[model samples]
Each structure stands twice: as structure tokens, then as C-alpha cells.
Target: MNLESLLLNNLHRFPPRVVAWIEKRLKAIPSIRQKIDKEYDDMMGGLESSLKPYKDRFPAFTELPAQGRDRAEILREMEAMQSQEEDRWREGMVSGAVYHGDQAHIDFLNRVYALHSQSNPLHADVWPSATKFEAEIVRMTANMLGGGADVVGTVSSGGTESILLAMKTYRDWGRAKGIRKPEMILPVTA
Candidate 1:
């Protein structure tokens, strides 16, 4: 049997620490290490082409350019790149990338973003509108979800941030309830 099969069949017989030690020793062998490296390199070589289609077409900068490129030229390059990458998401061929791909909706969002591009919500004194917008959004969402006046939430930039905020809130709530250790069970997929 191959090394993988041998390990898979026998790993359960040993403790986790013993299995880890054996794995480390096996990886330390020159032949085993070389074989593993070759396999990893081969896998990555296959993936690189698909992952970096623009690598050959676009100019990659390892360091800052001595002189800045023309604004029009940079915009043209960016537009071309976006056009090349957007088709799949726009066509609904991809999942979880573009939730709303309608042109009118996109244009409206673009206009809103342009208006508030320099507005930082952290500086609420300077950007009171940002705070108002976030509060309205949270209130509207809570109401829509059947939340009462006591429900509260903060707007997060994305999924990871939302998850982190939720976890912190739960931990704080647990602490207030005199729970010493707050534990959460999350799905494997999450």
C-alpha cells in the first residue's frame, strides 16, 4: 500500500501525539520531503494559470514606479480588468459574488458610493450622515426581521466582521449573565 493508505489505516491505532510525531519524522526524510514538495508544486502549477489569468496580460509592480502612469491609461487598464472578471458573476454563473447584478441597481449604488467615498463613519462628528444611514439600516433590518425596540445591532463591512461582532456580543452577554466560560458551536462549513 501507498504511504497515504498506510497512514490512514494505521493512524487510529496510535494516539494523536504519536501520530503527529510519526508524521513529523516521515516528513523529515529527504525522499519523503522531496516527494511531498514535488506533489505540492505540481498541484500549484495547475492552479496558478486558472487563478492568475491576468498575470501575463497585466503589468505587475514589485516596487513603486519612478513616475506615475497617466490617469486615463490606469482607468483603461482597470476597466479592461473589470470587464474580463465580471462576466461570470454578472451572468449568474458564479455564486455569492454579485448578489444584485442589475445595471440600474449597480449605477444607483455607484452614485451613492461616489458621494460618500471620502466619508469615514468612525468620525461620526464629521460624517453624521454615515451614522444616520447605518442606524436607519440597522433599525429597518431589525424591524423587518420581527425584532422589537430592544433589538440592537451594528452594521459590519462583511460576513467575517459580522460573525466576529456576533461572537463578541454573545461573549459579553454571557459574562453579564455570570457565565465564566462562553462556548460557541459553529458548523464545519462556516
Candidate 2:
């Protein structure tokens, strides 16, 4: 077999820490580092156009203006940008972007957001209502899922936060069980 294929076939035989160290050493080589950097740059260059379509069309503020812009003008610009970006998701061209795209559902969500925009659930003592809302939502979800009274959860802001929280919980649980090293197997997509 070829050297590359042979090394890859046996790579799993090495300890993870040793493999990581080897990888770090290989990346330290100037030629290898340059090739990796070039690959990253090329990938990002191809994505830049789609990722920042409004970069040239809209103004980007690095620092605050000496004087604040008019509120109405700012709102107009924001709404225009939002309208442009929301089209793909609204038409269902983008998957998972909008779970429910009905105008009435969006309007109702917007109204609820407006009502609690300033409330921070982290400060439960100050915003008990936010905490109460989250608790009720969690309880209802648990009941619907056929969970017993022992099933409890906290509300996460999004999928990423939920994933992070779950990972931390697992890590803590492993440690409590006297596991010195904890490893997770994740799909390539994750």
C-alpha cells in the first residue's frame, strides 16, 4: 500500500494524545503550514461572495459615528436588509431556517419578543416572569414526552447552546462517575 494509506490505516492504533502531538508537529513545518493555510484561504474566498453579499451594498460601522444616525433612517436600512435576507427562508428555499413561516405566527412571535425584549432570564430574581415562563414551557414539554417527575431541563437559547449544555452535563456526569478521561463520538456532520 501507499505510505499515506498505510499511515491512515494504522493511525487509530496510536493514543489520541500522541496523534494530536504528531499532528501539531507536522503543522509546525513551514511547507505543511503554508499548504493548509492556502487551502483555508481558497475555501473562504469561494464562500466570501455568498456569505457577505451585503458587504458592498450596505455600510459597515467599525466604530460609532461622531453623531448618532437618525433612528428612522437606521430602522429603514435594517428593514430593507431584513427583507432582502428573509426572502430565501420565506419561500422555503432554505431548510430549517423557519419552522413556521406563516405571517400571523411570525407577527405573534414578534409581539411576544417585544414584550419580553428587556427581560433577562439569567437574572431570575429581577425577571421572575421570564423564569416562570421558561419553567412552564419545560414542564409541558417534559409531560408531552412522557417524562416522569425526575425529568427536568433548562431552556437554551438555540440548538448550539443546547448542544454545549448537554456536552457539559455529560462531561460532569462522567467525572462524577470517576472517569479520568471522557470521549464523545460525533457524526461527521456534527
Candidate 3:
């Protein structure tokens, strides 16, 4: 029921100006605040119901003590889900995120993923395989540029963070060099 937290949680998915206007309008109208609360409750209830289609199929959490599910049983359930859901993505029916839809390519990636499933580059000593994979990925990317050998960078989720990070880095660099007003010009083209 915390409005501020809810707004901030949803900020990335919404326009900043729209969020600001909604916040302002909600604060201005007492009735709107109550309406927003009711809407949020309705939305949460609908989402919860939609998520748990097998609510009655599985034992209720309240009825059973918290315990780990058997590993084989868990894997069986996950494999069942993957079998049920793989067709849609495999045929490229979805809009985004799915890359290879062909069964052969999917199986190839699946096998590669399974091979490196236990590898975690976070601990290079424990998983040198992961470290090597990451190193080669970066190395190949760097090789594409004219300055092939010296290039170094990390992969990120998308352009938003990359732009933000670049801006912050430039800001810091400018400040360090005693620039009074550090401003980067943005392109006006849509």
C-alpha cells in the first residue's frame, strides 16, 4: 500500500513525466488515491490467480511444512513445463527474446548450456571453463574493432545501461579534470 515504493518500482516500465503527473494527480484527489488502492488490489488478485493454474494440483504451502522438493521430482516438473512450452518459441510465434527456433539449433544450445550449467565465472578458481568462455567472447568482440588487441569491455543487458554508464563515466572524468559545467550534447533526431 506504499504509493511511493510502488511508483518507483514501476518507474522503469513507465515514462517519467507520466509517472510524475500520475503522482501529482493522485495527491490532489482523495477519491483517486482510494481508487488506485482498489485497482492495485484487484490487479494483484487477478495476477496471482492467473499464475497458479495448478493451485489445486499441488499441495498448498500452508498444508505442508517448508521443505526442499526432491531433485528428480523438481526436474521432472521443469521438463514437463519445457516440453509443453517449447513449441511456441520453437516456431517463432513470440515477438521477442527467442533467437533460434529450429529444433536442431535449440538442441545444440541446450546441450552447450547443459555442459556449462555448473560453470560460474564469479569464482574463476572453481570454474575456469566459464572464465575461458567469457574471455573468448570479449576477445572476439574486441578483435572486430580496428584496435584489436587493446580493446576491453563488458557485455550488458541493453543500450540504456550502456548509455547511462558512458554518461556517468564522462561526468566523473570531467569533474576530475575540474570542469565547472560538464554537459554532453544529445542528438535531437528521433
Candidate 4:
């Protein structure tokens, strides 16, 4: 089977430990490593063309321009791209994106983003606004998910990061409880 199919098959069958073990063994052999690397590169190259359908529509950034252009010209080009791309999302043709699509709503959000564009949460002391946004976001989400009684959580980026954080927490808990090399069993499905 192809490498992608093999990876997906193993992912479906085994937990992370077994998969990592298998990957380690396969990469230990030079020939197997080379074969898998070549297959992965070929797969990625074939997928790139389909993934980057807008490469031709926008600048591909092959090389930097020798000279800088006027800010108005650059903004005009970007506006054109934004207008061209907005129609699909605004019409709800794509999935799970552009929940707020009205022009007024979009413009309001863009203005808010521009206002807070320089803010970074990592430096919460300098960007106290980011801290406020984070707290409000967490509060709103918690209330939406039935948070009146005992639910409490900090804001995280998304599901995968949250899962990884929880997994690490549990792993540390298990280690503290004197479990050696603690492994988790995840079920396999057809």
C-alpha cells in the first residue's frame, strides 16, 4: 500500500504509542527511510498544485521585487484579491467559515482587527487588551456550553491543543502516582 494509506490505516488501528514505535522502527533502516521520504515528497508535490489553486491568481513570491512600490498600488491589489475571495465565503459556499458575512459586519470586524493588530497575547502585560479579550472569549464560550454551576476552563486555541494539554496533564498525574511508562489504549475500528 501507499505511504499515505499505510499511515492512515495504522492511525485508525493503534494508539499514539504503537504508531510512534512503528515509525521509529521503519526509520531505523536507511532504505525504508529513503523510500518513505521519497514517497512523502512525491505525495506532497502532487497535492501542492491542487491545494494552491490561487497561486496563479495571486503573487507566488518566487523572488522579491528589486524596488518597492507605492502603498496605494499595493493596497489596491490586496483589495482586489479580498473582493474576489469574499464572494464564495459570503455566499456560504464553503463550509464552517465566514459565519458573519454581511458587509457591515465584515467591515466592523476588520476595523476591530486593525485596532488590535499589534496586540499579542504572549506579552499580556504590554497587551492587557488581549488578556481582556481572552477572558471575555472564555466567559462567552463557557456560558454557551452550560457554565453556570461548576464549569471552569481557560481559553485555549482549539480542540487538538486542548486534547494534547489534557493528555499531558493526565500523563503527569499518572507519573506522580508511580505508574511506570504509562500507556493508554485507544480502540480500533473498521
lDDT of 1 by residue, 23-139 (tens): 899999999899999999999998998898889998998999999989999999999989988887777788675788889999999999999999999999999999999999999
- Name the candidate that leads on lDDT: 1
Model 2 CA lDDT for position 70: 93
lDDT preference between candidates 3 and 4, better one: 4
Scored by CA lDDT, what does every candidate get? 0.90, 0.89, 0.77, 0.81
TM-score of each: 0.80, 0.80, 0.57, 0.55
RMSD (Å) of each candidate, 1 decimal? 3.0, 3.0, 8.1, 6.2
Q: Sort by lDDT, best first: what order?
A: 1, 2, 4, 3
- Report backbone clashes per prediction: 0, 0, 0, 0
What would the per-residue lDDT of candidate 4 be over residues 88-114, giving only the tens digit for each residue?
776778875556667799789999999
Stretches > 4 Å off in candidate 4: 1-46, 62-66, 147-190
**Which portions of model 2 miss their true places by more than 4 Å?**
1-35
Cα deviation of 7 in candidate 4 (Å)? 16
User: For candidate 2, lDDT tens digit of each residue in 11-127?
Assistant: 789998998997798789998799889999999988998898888887889998999999998999899989997988877788765789888999999999999899998899999
- Evaluate residue 133 in candidate 1 and report its C-alpha lDDT on the 0 to 100 scale: 94
lDDT of 2: 0.89
Q: List the lowest-lDDT window of 10 residues for candidate 4.
A: 149-158
